[model samples]
Target: MDRVWEAELRLPTPLVELRDPLFGTCRVLLKRDDLIHPDVPGNKWRKLKYLVRDARDRGADTLLTFGGARSNHVRAVAALGERLGFRTVGVIRGEERPTNPGLRRAQERGMTLHYLDRATYRRKSDPDVLAALHDRFGGAYVVPEGGTTPLAFPGLAELVNEFDRPYDAVVCAVGTGGTLAGIAAALPAGRRAIGISVLRGAWSLDAEVAALHRSVLGHPLDNWTIDHRFHCGGFARRDARLDTFLARFGDRHGWAPDPVYVGKALLGLSVLTGAGEFDGETVVAIVSGPGAG
Candidate 1:
């Protein structure tokens, strides 16, 4: 429990006030999870909170996790590890790049960086990769990519504590389904939870959400749902429309969105609402990260 805890932060990015004449009427409210920390920001920080505490409790001197070369999770974990007095090791996908920003930041923050090919990185979710990592790191505590695990759920469940209003629905961009699952578990009787997946073919998100629910609450949640059509060409891919939206969003709200995560999610919500999916309900959209612009 002696590990560093990033403060719980919130910001109001204009709610459903912007209207698209062709689309329909909808309000856009942003939950600024990105501003939760200066370096290890947003939902990433929330998910890692319990993990960091557990690492300290177990007397772990080093933290090991896996992600892509430019993963926001890796960058945030590196920053958090440095602040929390823990050495970090990130098993990154793709060939090693001497000029990778995430890698350079990790190195600057004293994190040991490990590179693996895409095929090998694909094995990261397997227990074998974890075992191999443990052998190499020698007692480094392992955190899953995206800091996902049962423990991470409760921190997100606590998000309901931050809101004082009655939101008809809670929405967020789903990467691994942790945040969406957490919200479903934390749902008050009448509220709906919606997840906009950033990955294509995210049909698996439902199963993942169910697993998280079972792991955290010891039961599957029956309430929440996912809308998978808005991935916008999957992670890191963007177009002019999204770019214009991001620019306008920043100009209007004074917040930045990384094209990979929040931008896609935000754009997805707009598309969904414009299609009359969110017709007449008050919704809270969780802006999970300010990972990159």
Candidate 2:
């Protein structure tokens, strides 16, 4: 929400070395996007810049958005709204259980939390459902779940500036496809954007991202593909292997991965590079985890 964003708003995210599994032959690097900001860090910050601008430009005083109970998007929107002078509302999916840290932070940031059952949450964008929210909130601007709207790309595309040169390929964990879409939107020539699905199910991520790209750029972009190998058995579903990998990764690299997004993408990077997937000298994984991890 700073006036500086009115310009190009190019960020300088750190790119750190993750591992040299092939004795420095096949090197893997981590794009430390999580360090981009404190309250609204990583991909969350990248996805919201233009969205916040759009809300303000429309003369909207209240910003309404959707996410899960523990969604980073919800917390980021709440924090940004509070700091930027916009009233925020969060449409949380699933029933509210006991105290959740993310939701608590959103509440502390003054976001009005509305809990919806799974069924209703799935239909959040339906006309009837949206109409209900409009009637109740009196015309607050709605940011889709995961902030994956057309407005998200401009901010996300700016993230491309963080990389001076393209690696063999750039990878990001996909939630609602906004992060991936933005990366693919500004994909430099000769570089590929790899979308690693962090959530399971039959939802066609390619189809969704294609639709989003078309809406924003007038056509779908090439040089991007989806990798379904890294969900770790669906969103938020952790097991012994994932836990062990996360622990070992943090212990070795000294950077703890957010169990939700960056951890899964890191696991995928290990798999792809170990199998000798790409022919480039360097591969980059956009790590939205804390600091170096």
Write down the TM-score of every candidate: 0.88, 0.91
How far does residue 10 in candidate 1 sit from its true spot (Å)? 7.1
Predicted structure with the largest TM-score when compared to the true one: 2
Q: In candidate 1, what are the lDDT values of residues 1-293, reduced to their tens digit?
A: 43235333343222333343322555555676776666766688668878888998999999998887778888888887877889999887777543476678778998888887788888886788777888888988888888889878767866665766656788788889988887787788988888878888878889988987877788887788888876667776777887887897778767657777777777777777777877776677787777542
- List, residue by residue over 207-264, the lDDT tens digit for candidate 2: 9999988888899898788888778788887767678888887777686688778887
What stretches of model 2 exceed 4 Å from their correct place?
3-10, 22-24, 95-98, 289-293
Residue range with the least summed lDDT across 10 consecutive positions in model 2: 1-10
In candidate 1, stretches whose alpha carbon ends up further than 4 angstroms from where it belongs are 1-25, 96-98, 251-256
Which one is best on lDDT? 2
Lowest summed-lDDT stretch of 10 residues in model 1? 6-15
